[model samples]
Target: MLSNKNIIVTGAASGIGAQTAKILKQQGANVIGLDRHPCTENVDQFIQVDLTDPQSIDDAVAQLENIDGLCNVAGLPPTMDRLMVMKVNLLAVKYLTENLVAKMNDGASIVNVASMAGIGWPQSVDAIKDTLENATFDNIESVCDKHDVEGPRSYFFSKEALLVWTMRERWTWRDRGIRMNCVSPGPVDTPILKDFIETLGERAEEDMKVMDRAGTAEDIAPVIAFLLSDASAWVRGINIPTDGGMSSHVMEQMHQFAK
Candidate 1:
């Protein structure tokens, strides 16, 4: 579905990012992989990037042209430093996407990897908007402090902000036929799965009990590949939960839906 496309997949070193790159390549895309670590297998080209650093992102973006798709799959788990989590998961994504949009071909697609943690965005709209307006590379610390985005809250807040940002930008490039969307996976079985479990503690344990099994990268990557392909040209500004029914279960409990 992605034949001859020039696609970019960040966090392409491992987990969902790595698998997504593989699938994109299998579908005939010329995959450009970006990650902090070296990844030489699934992608046609590898660009080393530190998502926490704007200059590194800018340097990587400078090397690209005629991009057909971008998958913002690189992210940090909640166990990492709180500030670094916010930077990698939220700030860097905004910077990279804003910078690369101009270079993308018309009708290009951008897919962000969000999380089920963001499902409570409605409860945090005001905070999300405030952060979106005030947070920057220069003053992220103050903004994060103002919003209480410390500890595991950093991860949740980042995903919430990302979901809202994606929706707001749905039509930003509509004139050029470009679109933005996201995938929110539940506790997936990846290298960082333990990190999430470690961070959320009892909540993570309860969620695992409710889930049939943790989702694999295999379950999530195809949905990302679809969003990055022409097949989903009409799917814009939506978050598809590729979480093996965990999202539905959460909503069921949230609203007290009849069993």
Candidate 2:
């Protein structure tokens, strides 16, 4: 159903984003892959972008002129800068969505590729709320200078806010017939897998119990393809965990598992 429909996939150079761009193209979307690094796939088009800069986002996406769907797969993951994580993961999401929303079809989709680290957003909402509001491309260095977060928590908070942003934007864009949602994957075996496992240290073993196995970019990318396609019409403002029921297992042990 996506034939000739222009779509944008950020972080298309590697991991989930790269896989997602490939999947979308196979499904017939005019895939525009955006990233700081060049992607290997011969996709519909490619535009290098440094998402930390608002102008870069504008210019990279401008290369598309207009698009039907946006897959926000760009991010630094955990074990990276707290502020940059938030900026790339959440702020850039807002930045691109705001700019591209006008260019999208009325019934287009906005899929924010979030993470399992974002699951506890309800509780941490207030703690990181200030940082999210203050995030800006022009002020990247300053935000990183202040309100420093460590380990997976930074990545967690960034995705958490993104999930929240998805829900919020769903309502914000509802009048325009646009839908916003998130896909949170668990223990994906992509390059970032080591980063997450490293950040968790010994706790990684226990965390793995939440899911039967680690996911792959292919496993998660198809879900984004669905959301970006007409397949997921009713899905909006929801974080659909593609972690092989791991999220449920963890949720089941919510009060039982300490840390």
Candidate 3:
């Protein structure tokens, strides 16, 4: 479905990013893989990048040609430093996407990989709005400091803010026919699965028990591919939960009282 297209897949070194890159390639796309680590599979080219560094992202984007799709699958787990978490998972994703906007084809699509962890965005809507309105690389630090985001909270908040950010920019590039969307996944079996287990403690175990199994990179890649394809031409500004029904289960509980 992606034949002849030039696409970029961030975090292509391992985990979901690697899997997504492979799928995109198998579907006939010329894939450019970007990551801090070296990726040896499923990519036509690799660009070393530190998503935490604006200069690195700038340099990476400067080398790009025509971009047809962008799969933002690279991210840090909660075990990383709080500041780095925000820089990579949120700020850099925004910066990198913005830099590539002009380089992208008019029919291009952007798919941001968010998490079920972001379901709590409602709790920080006010702060998220402020960041969306005014925060930039020059002032994101102050926004983080003002919100007192730290540790695991930083990871959660970054995704929460990212989901909101995705929705807000859904139409920002409409005049150019560029579209943006998000995919929020539940616990996934990946290189960093241990980090999630370590961070969430018993909460992670409880979720595991409820679901048949943790998600695999394979299970989530196709939805991302669909979102980035022309098959979804009419889809825009939507957040799809590619979570094996975990999201529906949560909603059932959240509204149990209504029943």
Return the top candidate by lDDT: 1
In angstroms, how far off is 128's CA in candidate 3?
A: 0.6
lDDT of 3 by residue, 1-259 (tens): 9999999999998989999998999899999999999987989999999888899999999999899999999999999988888888898889999899989998999999999999889989998888777777677778888988878998999999999999888899989889999999999999999999999999989989989999999999999999989999778889999888888887888879434
TM-score (all chains, Cα) for each model = 0.98, 0.91, 0.96
How big is the RMSD of model 2? 2.5
Q: Residue by residue across 7-108, what tens digits does model 1's lDDT show?
A: 999999999999998899899999999999999988999999999989999999999999999999999999998889999999999999999999999999
Clashing pairs in 1: none
TM-score of model number 3:
0.96
Per-residue lDDT tens digits for candidate 2, residues 1-259, read: 6788788888888899988888888888888888889875936788888887789888865766656899989889677866677678878888988988878878888898888878888887665576567767777556545655554566887787788777766777778678988999888898888888788877787878655788899899988988987888778898899998877777877867645
Model 3 per-residue lDDT at 167: 89
Candidates' C-alpha lDDT: 0.94, 0.81, 0.91
Q: What ranking of all candidate models by TM-score puts the best one first?
A: 1, 3, 2
RMSD each, Å: 0.8, 2.5, 1.4
Superposed by TM-score, candidate 2 places the C-alpha of residue 122 at a distance from the truth, in angstroms, of 1.5
Worst 10 residues of 1 by lDDT: 131-140
TM-score of 2: 0.91
Error of 3 at 100 (Å): 0.3
